[model samples]
Target: MVSRMFRIETGDDKDRRDLLRRRLLETNTAASPVLRALRGTPAERQRPLHLWVMDEADELAGGLVGHTWTTWLHVTYLWVDGRHRGTGLGSRLLAEAERAATERGCDAARLETWDFQAPDFYRGHGYRETGRTEGIPGGHQDVHFHKVLAG
Candidate 1:
């Protein structure tokens, strides 16, 4: 590839040309190691992973996981340790998840909780019941909730 340097600052042609040449050299050197490492590494595939852990007394209180896509954030899993129940940990976890979703540019967050799960907990946090499925031959059905983020 042919390399060329051009001045970018007004009225400082020589200095700008030198600066551009230095920048190009630095960029090429910075990327060479990564390129060489990936030459036999099968293209070095990667994916983004985010993890959050809540702890109490050195024990795991809860955790949440989600994946982001082009236009939406999908919540893959959420759990609060059984010993931490009734301690507001679940609500705090939900709030954290919502904050993360908003930060990731998601306009809304969605999740599902069983009938025997923390329905009231989610309701208290502004999540509204949008759907439900009953008569599953089990003791309880499933409920889904969603919250919209304000601009």
Candidate 2:
């Protein structure tokens, strides 16, 4: 046996984080044939898909921010102002985002919403609950949803 010494460190280090991500990507590509095939291809890159709705006064009414990669759309954020709620702005924003994602070659969409958020709203838009994490945010739950996009 050989003796060795190592020190542990942790913080918000961007360079190290990037290095770790690159290494993990390389390892996963080497381990998976599907990932290997995606390397260096256009589909390997995530494309941003953002949609915004503005009022006549130039104020933001609603918006959806997400990205598409490898035939899937990952919705990071979707929001509508209180005044715009129930006016169908949220639904319209989501529909436009899905349409754009479909145009980008995405076949599915996924997102997470807190229980206090619009889980039913997403379900109403044809998204189905795929996962749930309870006890989040003190007595609330985080719901994950997925939807198969129509061509």
Top lDDT model: 2
lDDT of 2 at 121: 98
Model 1 misplaced regions, further than 4 Å: 1-51, 54-58
Tens digit of per-residue lDDT, candidate 1, span 1-151: 7879776556658876767755764555457775334322211211222455557566667777765432244566678788877787766766666666666555776667788877887788888999998865676878888777654
TM-score of each: 0.57, 0.81
List the candidate 2 regions with Cα displacement exceeding 4 Å: 1-22, 39-44
Candidate 1: global Cα-lDDT? 0.64
TM-score of 1: 0.57
Cα miss at 71, model 2 (Å)? Answer: 1.1
Q: What's the residue-level lDDT of 68 in candidate 1? A: 46
